[model samples]
Target: MSVLVRTEGRETAAGAIRPQAGLSTASRVAAVTVLTSLPVFLPGAANGLICAELGWSPVRMGAVLAVYWLASLSGAFVSRRAALPPVVERTLSIALFATCLGLLTAAVAPAVGLWISSAVGGYAYGYTQPHTNALLMRRCAPRLRAFAFGLKQAAVPTATLLASVAMPMLAGAGGWRLVFAGTAVLCGAGGVFLVRQGMRHGIRPGHSGARHPAATRDRGAPLRVGTFLVALSCAGFFGAMVGNGLGGFLVLALTTRGVSLSAAGAVATAGAALNIAVRLAMGWLVGRVPQVAWAALTGLFLTGAAGTALLTRPGLGAITVGALLAYGGGWGWAGLLHYAIALPYAGQEQRATAYSQMGVSLGAATGPLMCGLLFQLGPDAAWWALTAAGSAAGACVLVARGHVGPRPDAGVSPARRRPRDSPRPA
Candidate 1:
């Protein structure tokens, strides 16, 4: 069963007061996110096999991935005006079903099927992102909210790790088609479970949670797009270029270095594992020390830059160390960033998440394209591009901090409000 917590009107020096979100609810949200994320990253994980069979170059593979991010970018922009489903379960189920369908479609013809399949997957990811954020924002305790976001965002690397580990073995066993088909089956099963839970929870179709038009309007209020928010999102854009580029190309880069596919996948898996651990740790740190959130993000990007520089060095030892640092420190702070962004917004988490997602999508789309273009110049050139992007992202975070630093409580301090008479469902 899911537990919901409504934020009290009162605000503290730390943040708003609310109960912790149920573990089951958070787990479901993460699972749905992982399922939706798979289609976008799977192409990268299985690029070698797919390219070998289809005669496509790395540039063409990058283009395919770009299409997916572009579709997500478009959807994120559109979500600014879209209404979320009444319940989180409905949204998660829809995303899961869409992901399942996309995977199944890609299984039919891994080559031509990728275009449409990836778009569908991207749409599902973009569509569900903000709704899930809003759900966590409304239901999670402010004290632990960063941790919740960390756990949720960890799903992305989890998907990438699963893809990196599973793709090669599955492809080797029965070719790439089997991999997609198997993933689709898993997605469909998850969808079914969510559907059943939604029904059991009394969230039937056409059941509007809002009692009046005014309440609905209030829930979908226009977003406050401030200069500070824009700067922060732009920082995310730059950081994603490095983070996503790292995940998308790590295996291929290692293969070029004369490592076996299985071994390369193992290295990628280690990076992803470290990434997951760091995200959770960062979230916990920021939640305990809210004052350090922005500063921690800035440091993460800088560390990512240093890691990218290491990748430019020769030998598997350098590559392994670089991948761990790059993936762990560089990409681990997304959940904290989201938590920080949503804290000041109070009730507008969905709209806030949409805008942030747009920046990430734009960065994700452009990053791989830039890397692929430079790939022809040699692997070091691609790594250098990522290094530069990571550094720029760190600078952007510093700019954002400057905007927030002068204000009381670092400018994100929630305004105090009158306490409610009693708690209620959010």
Candidate 2:
């Protein structure tokens, strides 16, 4: 069997995978980002609104969010075997459109109905990352893939930023429903736009140029490789814990510590802005930095832990400092860890990313519940719980790094994987 390839903006030697020169990445990136934000939008930025409007405690809101992520678990699993580009585009648009409907339902429906909406929306959320990864893998060059992933991930913070800014403006307008309804509209519009792009610039595999020798159709792999990849997957779980956990509770955490509601929202936005900046910059910096991927992953998590612990300190100044650290450092590792997950499984981008997504989704699904349980113990204690989770995740990255060794038979071409002082770790 031949290897699959990463032929994003260029072509390979004749007789290799087909060229996708005309395929504009902007559309794919937008599609994925919009879909990704749908399920996560409310849970991340509007948690305070959700709790207030529904009259539920933080724990109750966390439970609903947890269930939403849990539902995504299945989609992540099925992503192990990826589909053709057209299939991905079709499914992605349809699922995102459906998620928009679900978001609308969550906005207007009663308590029980809202939970049902979360569940429906969750299943659609699962499809976005893996499918998007598959698309990016095919489109991005190996050298620039990290940045590509980062650009796509920037949407997370973009979504958060929008929601955070709108929190106060939209509050009490029609309660949480108004915000949720807006989410539905955005996602639905994104889907329609992507589908139109897909129709115009369709998938054409026969035109593919260069192919990865190991990125073949065969699904099975060596046990050692699978075992090593699992460590990275575990790290993904921890990374998600940092992002989902923090994003879910930051506002509440600050409010509990005596910050006003608007102040808390502003803090969340600042942190999210920092996060966005770091992620976008992290990808570009990876090329300049000498640290190996695993080492960077480990350090990012540790920084997150420290930031979480810092929130234990009193005063607005400390809280602001902690927010930047937690958001910038804690949430920053998602793209880096994602890039690492793709390395060992070099050829099999879909399968590699599926494992990574599973880890992330599982962490995201459960992190809120775990943090919420700790929240009942107070903000300081809850942060400590986050610290513990972050520490564990760092350890996993350390372990995963050990296994990132040479695979002469598979991996990128020697010229492509040329050694420098350190490998890229975006």
Candidate 3:
């Protein structure tokens, strides 16, 4: 329970912590990518079928999502405790178990059973994210952190791509229940792999000298609250609204506008593919550019994409391609920059809390619900609404930049410093 502060050869530049060398950064990165990605694959493909069978309306579905996010927020709060190791490990195990159980329950149960199962799964997944991020960041080298994070982020789309192909085929032959059961098996396998990997590598569960007192005392600097929070909220709202909600719905919208299902699928696939590419590109960009400038650029691209979707005629292939590029680029870039920049403002002690609060306050669930309702209004209305929201988000970023000014010396706070003397986990 003792937190040791080691300050040997640690340096901060541009608001990031440079992790010292000693860990098997590659293995840790690989572990994070696989474990974090497995849970996301099922929801993207199965949500529609589950909703249809359950007879849940958009509002109800939104509420369900809200409950899941609330659970995630709760997990984030729990991670703030100094005794985070066992708590995290137990939480991960419970989450994986719940997710598997939920999937099995959905396969066999009626509407109420499915809903309850979904909620349980969501809560478990929410609890797991912060711990995973914290563990990865603390253990990785500073120079490789962004790239490592990008690699981890890429797991999402990769999983989704696999799910898109596999889930449909499984559902066709074995019913939705079978699909759920299969997903459960995958999650269970992933959880077991992570646990075994951690144990085999001798990686302990608790803080690894990163939360020591001297580091805390030296790095306890106050952050710019008003500007940072506003920007953070904007990024979260835009991210959840477009990236999570609208991206899922875009195919239907395109099909409604006379695009063939295959074409619509192609567009969606293209966007997702571009998302993976842009995320890696953005990770590299963040290390080279001003983080705020990157944020502004992301907002601009997103706003432009929204506008294009709103103003253009539906049949133009070139325009569609351009819009997807913009949409994918903005989302991929903004997500990386948002987390990278926001980490410095929060300090290490409160980073998890800050992320959770933003998730809640931004109404992560509500964004998609609102988009769904807008779809019911009219496709054009939905497009315009997204455009307007994107514009607002972009404007907020500009306003926030004015208020906070430039961050010339932004680097990781000492409070979140990693130990210089600790041996790298093999």
Best by lDDT: 1
Backbone collisions counted per model: 0, 11, 8
Residue-level lDDT tens digits of model 3 in 148-236: 55655666566667778777888878777787777777667766765664455433445363343322443533323455455645655
lDDT agreement with native, every candidate: 0.75, 0.67, 0.53
TM-score of each: 0.86, 0.82, 0.75
Question: Native-vs-model 1 lDDT?
Answer: 0.75
Number of clashes found in candidate 2? 11
Local distance difference test, candidate 3? 0.53
Order the candidates by TM-score, highest first — what do you get?
1, 2, 3
Encode model 2's per-residue lDDT on 1-426: one tens digit a residue.
Answer: 001223232434323423242124623564466555656566545676667767878667667778777777777777665553434566677776888888887777747756776787777767557666666555555545566667777777776666656766785686667877777887788778757756665546575644434444223542233545677788778778877888878888888777898898788878888887887777666634424454566787888888888888998988888878888888888777766665444445566677787888899877777777788878777788888888888888766555555553322221233122222333
Candidate 1 lDDT over residue span 173-263, tens digit each: 8988789889899888888887776677644456434342222435645665766578778877988898888877787888998999889
Report the poorest 10 consecutive residues by lDDT, candidate 1.
Answer: 416-425
Between candidates 1 and 2, the one scoring higher on lDDT is 1
Write out the backbone clash pairs for model 1.
Answer: none
Which run of 10 residues does model 2 get worst, by summed lDDT? 413-422
